[model samples]
Target chain A: MSSRVRKIRENAYVMNTIGIAVFIALWWLAVEARLISPLFVASPLAVVQVLFTQTASLAQNTYITLVTLVESFLVAAAIGILAGAVTGAFDVADWVISPILDLLRSVPNVAWVPLAIIWFGIGIESQIFVSAFSAFFPIFTNTYVGFKSVRPSFIRAGYNLGASDRDVFFRIRLPASLGQVFPGLKLGIQNGMAGLIAIEFLDSTSGLGFMMGEASDFFKANIVIMDMLMIGLLGFALTMTLVLAEKRFLGWQRRTS
Target chain B: MAQGNSVLEVKNLTHVYTDSRSHVETEVIDNVSLSFQEGKFVCVLGPSGCGKTTMLNIIAGFIRPTSGSVVFEGKEVKSPSPERAMVFQDYALFPWLTVSGNIQFGLMMKNTPAKVREAKVTEYLEMMGMKGFEHKYPFELSGGMKQRVGLARALAVEPKMLLLDEPFGSLDAQTRRTMQRELFRIMAQAKKTSIFVTHSIDEALFLSDRLIVMSARPTRVLIDIELKSAKPRQRSDKEYSEVYEKVDKVITAEVSKSIE
Candidate 1:
């Protein structure tokens, strides 16, 4: 088992190296041919220089963006999961709340920026609200579906074993539904981050999106490219961390499936 | 028939399911009456779609009958209780839980204390010959192993009765035979009143003290044969063949009639 794991790790490293090398080669060729104007898309070398030159400020901006994104995601996830679980478990709750959730989800996150600014003002709160709104729907829908779709046999088994309604929900239904909802949660967080960045680009005065907007306005294409790279890198890192956490926490689920 | 020792009594039970789209009321079980004696192994045998499973569900109180009642130990069953546990054909072991966890689930539901629940789980695990597989999840185990876990889970509760819905129907022939033997040994030891539903003729004859044969859809009891064999019944005995032939003839006729 150890040897197999080691081989898999080595293969992953090699694949990453091959991917980066190919990407760098393509970037170099594009720059040499001037296929992408320097005004719009800076050269790889220029972007790297900008990365070092603005490292401190860039890191600070990235930190701000990360904090806001994480806060929004955690809040949305907590609310969505709790509401979805309650609604899914109770028929009256589902009847009362599902339509309202659907209405909220219908309005796009970017469209909420104007109202969010009026309500929470142009700050982290507004951005967080936008992110939370963006994330809420998928997680809610997935969790509701997951809870509702649990097999009748399982519920019956629990009941026959003398489980109370509450016991059934907590012990059997919640854990079973997690198998379906976790993927949705991951997707919701990713989309929420994207939505946060979009809102920031349109309205915010700080964070990675604001940094990129400022660089674009000044025609500092390299700095703009660096910010975009930072966004991608951060998103990738966060998603990987979540996936790792899922694998660790849900090892029993993996073993079962 | 044993007198005044009935563990389960189903009287004139009927169940009708109404389709939402078609607005058609289909009667699954029609005016069925049966009584199971305490500590007896009774097998309900019938063809597919004969509502054998519906009968089991009604007895388990998983579904309400459209008419009549299922009385358990002189009390009418309104809802599922731990006194009656079911071992489903699919082995319905919670996919998220390990084998030990599944077995302990019933004890937990009954609010059995931690130490007692652990002891019961351990005992049943050993009885099921699944001692080392307690930590393995349902998906990691074979179909036979999963069934054993289901059986252990059911047994751990020490219910007054057990309901088995074709427990070995999904297994291969060899595994099915092995499981059947194992089931017999477990039932003999526990002496729990059991209602087993199966379509297999030999299986019913081999395992049951009394076999109730039913007609296909809109099912009703066609024949109830009492096997008077002593303990450790010999499959090749003349009396066993006689009982088998009697049930086989009745079921074959009923099946053909239903098809026509």
Candidate 2:
């Protein structure tokens, strides 16, 4: 059984590699045939070359974007999770705040860009605010659901076992909720990154999003393609990191139902 | 039956579940009085949806009785206390916690020192024959194993009274019988006051010293039979069968009348 699982994993990796190669080959063919203008579409090789030559500048831009993304997301996750957990723990808090959060969640994260610019101006702060706003709803909603969905029987069992209300929250509700909350956080982080990129593209003077916008304006198709790919890869890397962290933190959860 | 050495007294207990629309009220448990003595296992038997669980919940202080009092050891029961630990039908083991972790949770809640909690967890895990599976999660465990953890968790608290709501109802027949025997052994050793709720006639006869048969919703105690069986009862014995038949007839009659 173990060997079979290992073989399946290896086959999946090979298939993914082949898929990426085919996509690049098709893109290269399209560009070579001049079916599209060079100003509009760049060959994969040209994009890779651009990425290699401008490695230092790209890396610097990526670092700045990454820092801003992390700062904003962490702040939002901390506050949103804490608030959601608190509201979920207390009935009155849930009754008062859940409706307001639901209303806020309905408004698109991009819709906040103008307001964020107005509040924090066209800088890193505005971009961070936009990212934080985008990330907050998913984390809050998932956490609230997690907290509220705890089985009553568990609570009763805990109480009967001599647990205090505080004990019930910390030991039972919080742990139970994490099973739901982590997935929400993973989604929130990805959404927050996307929001950050959008804000940067619209108004920033630095970072990968800004670089993509500037390249598009100059019709530097290779640079634009390279920057876009970098953005996607970065997002993938961040998401994978979060997933790994979740697995480690929730090892006990994986064992139970 | 021995009387007047009551460890827990429930007087005129009543519980009502309110309808959301139209403000209608339906009583789950009607005015009922009962007393349980220490060092004896008491079973409350009734048909399904007969408020047997509701009565247990009232005593456990999970739900308030609309118009009565549950006095435990001469004090009025206002809320859930550590003195009354419960075992649930579904096991209700914390899915996120390991076997040892679940067993230790009650002690941790009482701010028991880490060393004492660790020892107690190890002791209970061993007692339940779950020594090596301490780190296993609930999903990895069989239904019987999960129930054992639930039992161990309740026992670890050393509560004055143990409340069991059909603790073995969800297990297989063989497992249920084994669990019943194990529970009897544990109860014999601990000698804590206990109240068990179940629909099984055989189960009630085997574990309980006194069986309180209840009528359907807005429930009331119909027959309180005192069994003379020795501890660790032999289910195949004539005396056990006779008691089972008697209790079965009483419950069947009560259920039929309630349906009518």
Candidate 3:
């Protein structure tokens, strides 16, 4: 490697730390200088202090949100992939079902929150329904397009190699479509988190979104900021998990590219 | 060379492709008739988009010709069957399957016993010179190696005939030469009836026992001649040049005719 490139690579982590430290120092300076109102923004110190003080509440609320997120995401993935495979594989089904899905997907997912609340009440059931509804569209659309986009030559090869129609579908089409499905699932998870937080803000008595809202009402800026940071952390962890899973399953794709 | 009985017969095949959206009809194949004897290698050379692939697909039973029939061993070919395996230009090996799995796919589909499938896969792996690469996926291999696996996957099925559609069209010149030599060696040993379609005159000359040159779109056989040249024929040889000149003249004239 060139000296410049080697120097950058070696100091990459140190540079990241320095950058973060500088950002935090600037924020502290802004608080101390009173350029920002104390009522609006929390000082870096105060947010960290709240992190230790409110650990129990943060843990409990995060656990609740995490559970709802997983449950709703699983539900979305199962139905989305199944429906997508069916609709994609059969022309008649695609013709009949895609228009309906398009219409349903057009109505903003939050629009269903009211109906969900009425159906399942202000609880985990309602939360999951709303979140899963939001998550479903991306996963379904990606999987459908994935299946639809299978190379004709591959299908012909499958049949030419003595495979039955069903064999060709299960063996060739399903696995080939998975490369596209991973991106959809990633987007689905991000959207699911959005829906979960939205529903929690509106109706839930538990979860991080509810806790953040309650803190905001009481003017606990530090607690609210800490909760926001926690949400960011959770989203990062979940996305990392998905990326790792994708690597494990689609190793062939990575090697090729 | 003691060629066997007629294995595949194409009688007056014509195909018209219709675009459902634009409602435009394209007559791709124009009443072409041909036949293949058992254990003979036939190579088809044609202008680009002259419906060579359409003819191959029709013979492979992947598509029905608009008119006429394709009969193989006295049976009408209505749909794709394992008996006629094809090697594609793109090397259409399953991306998800390892090399071994790809070669064994046909056996698995046939519901051959596990032991037999394993044996067949191993046999083909050796034959294709891909012995140690069984665990590797298609994407991990070079283009030449991928086509080797593709050939293994096709030949493992013990098909009655092999159909290759520009199998080396995508390869580098050096790799194409290597693959062509490998293919010739393997086919000679197996002595299976084979039909190959390509755009290269030299490739057709180098590989085929019989050669068919096709006309432009709405394609028909312009010439079909048995190559009486000896095996491993050199391009520089007097006989090779004589036949090459004859075939090259026909192709050049047809290409200019299309331009006009």
Which candidate has the highest TM-score of all? 3
**Which model, 2 or 3, shows the larger DockQ?**
3
The better candidate by lDDT, 1 or 2, is 1
Better of 2 and 3 by TM-score: 3
Tens-digit lDDT string for candidate 1 (A55-152): 89898999999999999989889988989898988999999998988887778778999999999999999999999889888888888998998998
Question: For every model shown, what is its TM-score relative to the native structure?
Answer: 0.95, 0.95, 0.96
Better of 1 and 2 by DockQ: 1
Residue pairs clashing in model 2 are none
Worst 10 residues of 1 chain B by lDDT: B226-235
Model 3: per-residue Cα lDDT at residue B189: 83
Per-residue accuracy of model 1 over B1-260 as CA lDDT, tens digit each: 36449888999998898899999998888899998888788989998878999999989999989999999989999999879999999888998888889999988876789999878878988888888887888889888999999999998988989999999989999999899889988887788889999999888888888989988878888898787887456779787888788888988887898789
Query: Second chain TM-score per prediction?
Result: 0.95, 0.94, 0.97
Off by over 4 Å in 3: A1-10, B1-4
CAPRI tier for the interface of model 3 = medium
Task: Give the distance in Å from residue A241's predicted Cα in candidate 1 to where it truly belongs.
Answer: 2.3
Candidate 1 clash pair list? none
